[model samples]
Target: MALVFRPDKKSIEKTLAALKSYGNLVAPDARFNYDAKDGLRKEVCFRDEDFLSLLSSIDDEYVVDSILEMLKGKALVPPDAFYSKDAFDKLVALTKEKWYYPWTSFTKAMRRLFYMLASIKQPRIVVGMGIFYGYTLAWSAGPSCGKDKLYNAERVYGVDINTEAIEGARKNFAILEGSDHVELIAEDGRLVAQRLEGPVVFLHLDADGEKIGKKLYLELLKILYPKLAKGAWVLAHDVTDPGFQKQGVFTEYLNYVRDPKYFSESILFDIDQCGLELSIK
Candidate 1:
């Protein structure tokens, strides 16, 4: 019966105790806070907005990791302050693919994707190839496993082809609990590489077409190769969607499938029988 996004630990504890009085808190922290004023000086506060603002200050790479822990239902515990890269990756993947609950499942997918990227060595940047309303909304939810972790990403960017989608993404982040961790760009996803100035920890090509997705992926590799961290994570969503197959998007873009340079890795999920993960290792 815990509330949502409790910023400060002390306040969160008090809130949790109070929420237990209610019928298994589903969203008590929906709007809770803790503030103290001394003379003419006001100190810290613990509101959902404040919690989100705190998340905004986080580094992009770590943000995903932090949120993964939070959604796992671990961040609520008193902190012993531990950070393990391997532990993080395993935990993230487990939480996402293993956790229950419809909303929590979405958060887990995002966490799995984000943690995979964050774990890459010395990544300098991360990008969301395209932002759509449903996708962004799905990405914004917290972790489904650990609770102690908080967001800590370094540099992040979100790109999109639709202006309205971009705007919706912006508004979504504006109201979400921890949106300050990302940057949103309402532009064509194909040009993300040209626009970015650093190595990529992760890249997601979620545009609605195979041609554009392929072009963007190749362009990103060409422009950002030097900056690409070894073993970095790259994600392509809806790669096997009916529309893509119907239009032969994958066949058109992958006409000459490259060898060893890239390989496919699949992620199995119980939610969707068609769910398959594609990656190069």
Candidate 2:
């Protein structure tokens, strides 16, 4: 249930030949990359362009469209689904206007992917773990709880370990157009998830742990595994391919999602070095 994006092949061609070609690329026997975070955190080689080199060698919109096509093929979204350009622009601009934090790691493609998943899935309850400034929360919650909401959401909760960051994110979310359903909680992600009763429609993970960092994803997933409703979507940020990932952090996490015993299917959006993984329950 995993996918791969190849630079030589241009896009993820989902044909039989393409899948066969990507076999070696995604083989489990591949060596792990410990410094996978280095390339992601480094600056642009060229001065004036995107500091993160958001689109280093590929077209941004094209990558998004290709991923959407893959999702459509999997029947996760409509045949002709497309996230609105104006809506996405407004969401980004508004968040930038009121943002209190100095950093948000999500690049443009990653942000769009989160928004697309939310809008398409139309999840009723969206939970974000390790939400720093609610930037990730806003992207996923935009379609249902923000100023540019396409539909209303019942509840959207953001859990963060940093009390001061949560306070800043609270102020940022306070300015959303129709974000009454959104709440920022200053608590550990696992604890907040443990408190959830049931039927959490959507979950976003981007937390950093003291020892494991992103590996806490597996623990959070196990906690909410029973509460997730049918067709629920779980997104883990930074679940990139082997070379662009930290060692030992996501091995068990990815295995859980790829297992049919848990998620029905999982796809890795490797458009960015800092990738996103989507799993359906």
Candidate 3:
């Protein structure tokens, strides 16, 4: 495939440098970071009070739309597939109402993209690694669950290392109707991926490794590669979540997925402050 939306390393580098130079995305005063009390991995990350407000801001939606078009252009998305905004919005509302985030940089566009992935792919098995509070997993499997479910799915699993977070996720998912198909487990992500049954169609990677958080994305992909379906899509989050500050972890990841030897195609989208790398196998 001739990818029109491949990773833009230079632009990402620039954005990272600017962010580091200016710093502190949560406030105008530049007072916090990923390590702050309510920063990156806290019980609650700083974000818009509600998802409706976040989705309402569509000024940069063209960025996500361009990516959707790219997926369609490259035939990654089915020609007959479509996702309803009303459905997606409802999913967002339900998630915001029922779920809690330990920490995330998830943006409106990113959530929409993940939800759309489910609507289009209609995967039988969906797996999420390092799903902090299950929201990421919920988004990836949105169309398969909930009252507005777009399709029926066989199984959806979310793996996290934090037992407490997984406990919270279980309770949250239990409250949401039609989410019985979704399972939350607290274990090593790599171990769970290796033990998975077969042919996972949609994989969401947000697992933080021993060293750099997102560096583990590559390892997860490598392990899951053989188990991936023919047209599987791997969504790696935080590909540029201050990656420039982490010494080329994401760069190596970008290179691996972009290379035709491993993946048929790869594209990097930085719609939100964070980046999501989409790869097809």
The best candidate by TM-score is 2
The window of 10 residues in a row where model 1 has the poorest summed lDDT is 267-276
Model 2 stretches with alpha carbons more than 4 Å out? 1-58, 241-246
lDDT of 1 by residue, 1-281 (tens): 98776257777777676765653222544433335442232433332334333443443345545544553463322244333455555454543454322231123334444443343322345676655642432232222112423444566677777777777666655543344556777766546667676656565555553455444555554565555565554555544443444455555334322334553332322112112233443
Query: Candidate 2: lDDT of 23?
Result: 50
TM-score, predicted candidate 2 vs. hidden true structure: 0.78
Candidate lDDT values, in order: 0.46, 0.78, 0.76
User: Higher-lDDT candidate among 2 and 3?
Assistant: 2
Pick the winner on TM-score between candidates 1 and 3: 3
Ranking by TM-score: 2, 3, 1
Alpha-carbon RMSD, each predicted model? 18.9, 11.1, 12.2
Candidate 3 residues lying further than 4 Å off, grouped into runs, are 1-57, 60-62, 244-246
Candidate 2 per-residue lDDT, tens place, 1-281, comes to 89975344234233435545555333333323434583463333322134335572346667777788988997878897777767887888887776777787787788887887787888889999999878888888888855456888899989999999899888988887788889889998889888887799899988888777778889999999899999899999887634425255687898989999888889887666567888999
TM-score of 3: 0.76
RMSD of 3: 12.2
